[model samples]
Target: MDVVVLIGRILFALLFLGSGFGHLTQTDAMAAYTASKGVPAAKAGVLVSGVMLIVGGLSVLLGVWADLGSLILLVFVLPAAFLMHAFWKESDAQAKQGEMVHFNKDVALGGAALMLFAFFAHNSDLGLTITGPLFHLG
Candidate 1:
C-alpha cells in the first residue's frame, strides 16, 4: 500500500477508535443526551453507543469486516444526525444552527468512512470475505 493510504487508514481508524473510547468513558453524558433527544429508553443508549464504538472502531483498525462496521456507523449516525441534531427546522435559534452544523459534519465524516471501507475492501485479513470480485477495470 502507498504510504499516504496507510497514513489515511491509520488516521481514520484513530478517529473512530478515539470516538469509541470517548463514548465508552462518557456513557452517562451520552445517555443524557440521548434522553434529551427523546430516544426511547435513554438508559440503553450508553450500551448501544459503546458497543457500536468498540465494534465499529475495532473493525476499522483491524481492516477486517470494516465495511460492515462502516455500515453500522452509517445507520447509527444518519438517524442521530437527523433526529437528535435536528438539522432540519426543529433547531432552536440560539444554538440550533451550531448543533446542526456539527451533526452535519459528523454525517459527512461517517460517509467518508463508509467510502473508505469500499476503497480498502480488498485488504480484509480477519476472516471476513466478500462474495464477489470488487473491481472491474478490465
Candidate 2:
C-alpha cells in the first residue's frame, strides 16, 4: 500500500515535472502563446510557473513539504485554467472543443492537487510519508 501510494505520487508529479521542463526548454514558444492569451509579463509568467512546477513536482514526488507543493500548483493552475483556456470565448468549434478539454483537464488537476494537500498535509496514513529531510535517504 505504501509503495502504491509512492508510485501514485510519482505518477502525479511527472505531469508537472515534464511541463516544467517544457517551459524551461521552450521559453520563446511558451511566451508567445502566453502573450497571445493577453497575459501580462508573459515571459516572466512562463519562467516563474516553470520554477513553481519544478519545485512543486519535486516536493510532491519526494513527499517532502508536499502540501506546500500542492498549494503552489493550485495557485498556478487555477488562474491559468481560466486565463488560458477560455473556451466560452472561442468561436470556432474545433478551437472551442480543444480549449474546453484543456480547461477541464486543468480544473481536474487543480482539484487533485487540492485534495492531495488536504489529505496528505494532515493525514499520514493515506500516502507517502517523509521523515526528516529525505524519505528515501532515511
Candidate 3:
C-alpha cells in the first residue's frame, strides 16, 4: 500500500513537475502564450507558477508537507483553469473542443489536489503523512 501510494504520488506530481520545468525553461514562449490569453503580468505569472509547481510537486512526491503542496496546487490550478482554458469563450468548434478538454483536465487535477489536501488534513494513514508544521492539522 505504501509503495502504491509513493508510485501514485510520483505519477501525479510528474505533470506539474514537468510543466514547471517547461515554464522556467521556456519562459518567453510561455509568457507570450499567456499574454495572448490576456493574462496580466504574463512573465511574472509564468515564473511564479513555475516555482509553485516545482515546490508543490516536490513536496507531494517527497511525502513531506503534501497538504501545503496540495493547497499550492489548488491555488495555481483554479485560476489557471479559468483564465487559460476558457472554453466557453471560444467560438470555433475545434478550438472550443480543445479548450474544453484542457479545462476538464485542469478541473480534474484541481479536484485531485483538493482531495489530497483533505486526506492529509485528516492525518490519515492511507499514505504519506503531513510532516510540515504549517500543514499539520493536529
Residue 41's lDDT in candidate 2 = 97
**Global lDDT of each candidate:** 0.66, 0.86, 0.88
Judge candidate 1 at residue 115 and give its lDDT: 79
Candidate 3: segments with Cα more than 4 A from true spot: 124-133, 136-138
- The predicted structure with the larger TM-score, 1 or 2, is 2
Q: Which parts of model 1 have CA positions greater than 4 angstroms off?
A: 89-91, 122-138
> Using alpha carbons, what is the TM-score of model 1?
0.75
Pairing residues by index, what is the TM-score of model 3?
0.92
Instruction: For residues 35-91, write the lDDT of model 3, one tens digit per residue.
Output: 999999999999999999999998888878788888899899989999999999999
Indicate which candidate wins on lDDT: 3
User: How displaced is residue 31 in candidate 3, in Å?
Assistant: 0.3
Model 2 off-target regions past 4 Å?
Answer: 125-127, 131-138
Better of 1 and 2 by lDDT: 2
lDDT of 2: 0.86
| Candidate number of the best TM-score | 3
- Arranged by lDDT, best first: 3, 2, 1
Each model's backbone clash number = 0, 0, 0
